[model samples]
Target: MQPLLIYNTLSHQKELFKPLTPDHVGMYVCGPTVYGDGHLGHARPAITFDVVFRYLRHIGYKVRYVRNITDVGHLEHDADEGEDKIAKKARLEQLEPMEVAQYYTNRYHAAMDALNVLRPSIEPHASGHILEQIELVQKIIDAGYAYVSNGSVYFDVRKYQEDTKKYGCLSGRVIDEMLSTTRELDGQEEKHFSGDFALWKKAAPEHIMRWNSPWSVGFPGWHTECTAMGTKYLGETFDIHGGGMDLMFPHHESEIAQQTAVCGHGPCKYWMHNNMITINGQKMGKSLGNFITLDEFFTGKHELLDQAYTPMTIRFFILQAHYRSTVDFSNEALIAAEKGYARLMQAYKTLGRLQPSKTSSVDVKEYRQKCYDAMNDDFNTPIVISHLFDMAKVINTVNDKKATLTQADIDELKGVMDTFVFEIMGLRDEASSDNTALIDGLMKMILDIRATAKANKDWATSDKIRDELGTLGVTVKDGKDGATYEL
Candidate 1:
């Protein structure tokens, strides 16, 4: 294993990862809010951390990965007058709040499944962890970092800063500046300062997702649930906490404040944030009305999409760029990714058939080390992908007799490509997942009929079958051993 250095957002530098327990790691990533369909913004962080999870396991570490489902406590606005996102959506739809949560949670899971992201070890939901959240709020109050305003408990941002001087250390915002910039609203009369955030929000009479806390009948604050559930599962101090770059501010900053108040320190050692997805160089977000859902991209239903893109193409498009870079979505980029993915898979198939010669032309061992080096340096996936393309070029050269490889080298090349392409990167062939059994059976039947026609010397029948299948977008090729077709 190579030394893995991850970019830590707290220190604003890349540092060598040193887990508290030797050969063991703990990670927690912020999951979806589950109030609506997942958009491209949701996919970026999911896939980014999925790569981190995969590569951590590959490096021979025992990992406890916990990504939480936020079913409640996320407000549409940052102010006190804001409504719960789930409750607001449910109120408009005339459905139960939990029903809305469950429906979108299933949809989110399905979309993640299509992207081939691995499930986290523990996906604790916010609704089911009210007791934990209540206990955490009590901890903050006991620490003298929070206060009860009317019926709700608020985290005293100014007082916490006075105690630790660590407030705004992660986000680099001056506490005084934040106080001036935050809104002064109609419903914030209980708060002593405009920047103070609710640890427990008193529920409105019509609020659907109310819980019984010591303070009042209300719901947990948007930022408190993560702190409670995170410490509950990954301990007070853990290895990594990951989310989108958009969350680097207020949300994660608030999370850090709550956790530090309770535990006497920041929660996680390494904070990783993946950059957002942009459209035409502008940020793609729901508020901007430029967001495109995953289903819309899959069906090519959005006006911005030129054609329906496959799951693999979407995955490859994301992986082609460094995780920390903002990936812009466009039809030309997606089409190029689809073509590049096809070429890489074809080379993978070709490597299996490349005949070994008496001598070798390429040193696959060096390429294997380079692949590891790419991933080791902050999980730079674009560099690893570039290395994969270089290997593909070697495979093509050997297959075309422009280069030669010994049997041992050929076997090593296969192992290296398999480990990097399939295991570490977690990419799969698109054809294998789309109606696999039916397509395989249909192709087998069609090829068998073509073979029978050729065996009988029925040129007319064989050529017609081949020509008609071509008209339907299937290409058939004959060789010495047999025939193969691809769609």
Candidate 2:
């Protein structure tokens, strides 16, 4: 088996992945904030890491994947300057903060389910881990890398840089440049330096998500939640930490700083980040006002969408690009993806019904190793998909009676398709799941009737049945064995 080589954002190169503990892997990914509906931006990281989780398990590793939910302390500006995003929504709607969080959280889960994103092993809410966050903040303060001011505590970025000289190691930021250009924000006047971020913020009088801590009645900062929750669930140092490329600057950089301050080392061995989904070459995000929610994409309710797309189509679209590459969305792109998904599923069905010949005319055994090679190369999904499409063409040729494969080759091709197409890539046949049994029975009966018509030499009745079914978006084909239908 080829060793997995993943690109580490910290090292800026692909490195061989070796787990800390034998046969076990720990991965932590930054999950949704849950103040609003999940968008294309949110789906990128969720689906990207879900593949990582699936492949790790599929390769015989005991994987504990932790994805955190930021239910509180995520402010309007991701820094400590603005209103809490969830609390602001709750105030606007005149509801409790947790009510808003739970409502949107449920919606996020629903969208993820529709996208076929597998749920993480542990989904920790920031609100549920206040004590751990407070303890982490205390550790930073005790280590002299943080300070208390005005009932709130802030990480001392200047002190951390002065001591360790590694404050921006992951982000490649120069401390001098950051200190010179950093914008001063509200409630940050008490900080020792403008670049220092909040560990815990003292709750304002109107803040809805307040918790008791040594500094004040407050909540954990946006950066502290992941550090605390990840450490609590996956230990101080895990195998992989992943999120979006947009978070490389302050979010993940701060996570490294906090963990270094506490444990004298960074949190993870390898840091992975998936690139963003863009609209017309611009990043699609809630803050950008250009994001189309997953629901909008599904229903074609958004102004930008040309047609409604299924869950599997969306999943296939994302998988068509490498996780590290920016995928720009357009109507033409998604329509192409939908057609490609349909063909892939059709080829899979054809593979299942293929008859083995006495001898082989094509070699099908190499596809399995080829797929494993693609997966081993930093989870390069597009290459894997290209290989699958190549095999799909072969399957089509064989179905057309233009090629033949022995039983062993046929079984190997089936295993390759099943393992890579459905298992690792995480695509399902939407048609198979959407009342397929009923449709299969109906198609069987209709085909049987058509067969009877042909057997009785009633050409008019058979032709009428075939033409009417074709008008209803079903194609009927007559073969030597029997008649088959495609919907």
Candidate 3:
């Protein structure tokens, strides 16, 4: 078997994956803010890391995957300036902040479930870990890397940079350039340097979500949540930390600084980031008007969609591209993905009904190894998909009586397809065989009733049944022997 080589964004290269402990992995990925409906952007990271979680477990590793829910502390602007996103939503909707968070969090989970994304082993909410974040702030203060500014506490980027000279290592940003180029926000007057970020923000009297901390009545800064929660759950250093590429700069860079300041080292061994889903080459996000919610895609309610696309089609569309590559959304692209998914599923179905022969004409074992190779090379999903397509061709050819496979070879092919397509890649037949059988039985009964109506010359009843079935997107065909339905 090829050794798994994951691309570490920190190292900027693919490295052999070696868990801190044998056969155990601790991975953390930044999850949604949950202030609004989960859009196409949210789906990318959830599906990407879900595959990582799935593959690690499949390969005999016990993985602890922690994805945080940012219910609070994330400001309207990504920087520490604007109103809290959840709080703003709460105010607009005339509900408690937690109510807004809970509603959106539930919606996010539903969207992820529809995409077949597995739930994380641990999902810690930032609002729930106030003490942990406060302690983290104090640690940075004790380390002399952060300082109290008025009632708020700010991480002293200049001091940290001067002491360790490692402030921008993860993001490859020079501290000097950052300080000079940093924009002036409303609270910039309190910071020693423009580049300094908030560790704790002193809440105004009107701030809905405020906690009584050692400094003041305040809330943890946006970056403080992940640092505190990750350390508490994954220990000082863990195997992997992942999120979208958009977080690489301020958010992830700040994480590195905070962890390095307190622990004298960074948080994780590897940093992984999946690229964005874009519209007209612009990043799709809640802040951006172009984002289409997962619900919109499923219902075809959005102006951009021509027809409703199933959840499986969306998942297949994401997997057809490498995680590190940008995916530009288009109606044409999605339609093509739907067709490709159908072809793949059809081939899998054909493989099950294939007959075994005494003589084998094609090699089956090599494809299994080729798939392993693709996955090992930084989870190259596009290549793995291509290999699966080739395997599907072989399955189609064998089914067409153009090639033969021994029973052993046939079994091997089945195992390979099952492991890669379902177990590892996490794709399932949308039309489950059991469900199909049930639908078939119901349709048969309905058609039988319709036939009796026609036989009895009850033209009104027969026409009504036919028209109703048509409305439901089912067509009834009268054949020589009986009636059959197409859905």
lDDT per residue for candidate 1 within 127-205, as digits (tens), equals 9999999999999999999999889998999998888898888889888898778777755788888888888888988
Question: All candidates' lDDT scores?
Answer: 0.89, 0.89, 0.89
Give TM-scores for every candidate, taking all chains together and pairing residue i with residue i: 0.89, 0.88, 0.88
**Candidate 3: tens digits of C-alpha lDDT, residues 68-141:** 99987475343545577677768889999999989899989988988889999999999999999999999999
Q: How well does model 1 score by local distance difference test?
A: 0.89
lDDT of 2 by residue, 1-487 (tens): 7899999999999999999999999999999988888888899999999999999999999999999888984853435466887888899999999998898899999889988889999999999989998999999999988999999898999888888898889889988888787776787688878888888888888898899998899788889989999998899999999999888888999999999999999999999999988897786765776789889999999877889998888899999999999999888999999999999999999988888899889887788888888899999999999999999999999989999988888888888888888888889988878997898999999889888998899999999999999998799988888988887
Off by over 4 Å in 2: 76-80, 285-289, 436-487
Residue 131's lDDT in candidate 1 = 94
Residue 424 shift from truth in candidate 1, angstroms: 1.1
> Candidate 3: worst 10 consecutive residues by lDDT?
73-82
| Candidate 2 TM-score, C-alpha based | 0.88
* Model 1: CA > 4 A from native: 436-487
How far off is model 1, as Cα RMSD? 9.1
